[model samples]
Target: MSHHIVEVKDLHYTYPDGTAALGGVGFRITHGESVALIGANGAGKSTLLLHLNGCLIPEAGTVRMGDFPLTKKTLPHVRQTVGMVFQDPDDQLFMPTVYDDVAFGPLNLGLPPDEIEDRVMEALATVGAAHLRNRPPYRLSGGEKRAVAIASVLSMGPSILIMDEPSSNLDPKARRQLIHLLKSFEHTMIIATHDLDMVLDVCGRTMILKGGHIAADGPTEEILQNEPLLHACSLEKPLRLQGCPVCNPVRA
Candidate 1:
């Protein structure tokens, strides 16, 4: 049997404003797999991610993490297992100091003081941001803030990492650094973003969302190569890589 980490079945969600965020969307993610959720603005990628961590309960259908289903009683457990990183780091990091922000989750879980310290240090190191531990979050640059946000979730030692637009508002250098950090993580990851290049580099599979539903799902290379489908969904086609003639011979 396949070891699946996340499963969503016919999930549907609508906001209080009566906006349908997710419309009968469904998908399953196997343990250790890196998947990307790609879509245009208002495609419901964030809404779908919120369901994974129980931040938004589905009006219909269900979201399951491991063997536990997301419900009122199971939200805490589900959240502990699934760490969510929002598009804007400011929304996630609110503590006065970077250390406190990074240590918040483990502290809330009631870990020992020593253990919390260790977790905070480890998480910061993982994101290459340990040097900024004592600094205030507001003092950091956009990329640094993003790293701090990720460290906060990492402190919880979550098995699955769910990120929404991780590459947004980042410079080229920062974007590359973020990609390197993400690639180093062994945890299962589900990223929702419009960065097709990042998706091709970090994710093996891609799921395109449209009108709150999954419009296409397949291997990253194959899906990105389909120009018509990509254009229809308001997504850009993937860039092709050039190869040396000696390394990649053309067919006769």
Candidate 2:
């Protein structure tokens, strides 16, 4: 049996302005699996991720990381275990240089200076940004900044990675490179994106969020192939890979 790394039960959240973001959303993510969270705008994908890392505490229900539930006492451990990369790399990368940005997490965790340096180098190398370590984040291109942001999360050695719209603003080449990089990671991943093509390429499982609720959850190809269901959720079905047997195989 698969051991779940993240278990969310009856999770609910609302904004400070009284807008309900998640309405009893529930899901389980197994270790080493890459899952896609698909939804239209305002469907609560980002809100759901915030709860996973304790950035936004729920008004009700519970979010568990391993056996520890997300509470004030457990939030620190949960945040270390689950790393989130937001939609905008600029928002996540605020340090002076790429190296400092990547080293920030380990430093906060109180790692030795030498160990933090080692981790920073390894993470930058993993993301193919080793040479940009000394460069300031404000000077890097969109793709380079995104790569550095990913390196920052990876430096912490988290077991699970949660990304929100990773490919939102990248060009075709950059998006392809990002996808390849993500595919190489062994950790469990939950990617929130509207790019069905990305979901098809990088994830085996897909979950659809509609009106702050889980409307569909299953194999990636199966969920993407369901045109009527996608339509009802206000999501667009992929045009190119729709019926291609090689690309859209039956769910096992």
Candidate 3:
């Protein structure tokens, strides 16, 4: 499964506006690992994710997806191997109908009509969105739209799944459903989100970014439970790990 491994060494990037996004960030994610990237806003989580799929090339350093280095020549193959789901479902659901949106990637790959149909159906089914295939994307709820967006990526048959704020805007029930769905996927997943509680449930490892650099990386529970470290990075313990107000009321 070396083809599923993702590695970054001395990764660095800066926007045209002179804003540094990543500062010598480096890590290795082996096949089938579910990892979470958590940090406050402007912490470089999204920037790091974008580089994994060749969305934004690093100004310096190197990114290797599987055995091939990330370059213009290898970009197509890297993109095919790494599937990215943007923070907003609307960004991915531009096609008129859910089916069309899900089939977009496969269609771009030049898949035959019958194979495209099969991939579309299978992808929708995998995300439990098959019943909504005929509906227009704008008509679906936030959770429904998120499902279809994920289906679109799955249709491309990617080995690595990278998601940005996937549970944002979802209701409690929808969020729970999303968590369950994430748990079921066997793909190598890298999720960047502020939902530390959800990370506790879905990811085994966590990396905290601060000021465009990684401040902490370790097992999820261990990293999240470190209150001082989290505080310094503008984070808090996952609510699940905090003492309940009802059980341990504060005295002022």
- Scored by TM-score, the top model is 3
User: 115-229 in candidate 1: lDDT tens per residue?
Assistant: 9999999999999999999999999999999999999999999989999999999999999999999988888899999888898899998999999999998898899888889
Candidate 3 or 1, higher lDDT: 3
Number of the top-ranking candidate, with lDDT as the measure: 3
> What C-alpha lDDT do the candidate models reach, one value each?
0.91, 0.90, 0.93
Worst 10 residues of 3 by lDDT: 243-252
Looking at candidate 1, the ten consecutive residues that score lowest on lDDT are: 236-245
Worst window of 10 by summed lDDT in candidate 2:
239-248
- Report the Cα RMSD per candidate: 4.3, 4.3, 1.1
- Report lDDT (Cα) of residue 220, candidate 2: 93
Order candidates by TM-score, high to low. Answer: 3, 2, 1
Q: In candidate 3, what are the lDDT values of residues 27-75, reduced to their tens digit?
A: 9999999999999999999899989989898899999998789999999
**In model 1, which regions exceed 4 Å deviation?**
1-4, 240-252
Per-residue lDDT tens digits of candidate 2, residues 1-252? 232388899988889899988999998888888999999899999999899899888889998886678899998888888889988998999999999999999999999999999999999999999999999999999999899999999999988899999998898999999999999999899999988898899999999999899999999989898989999999877756556767678553
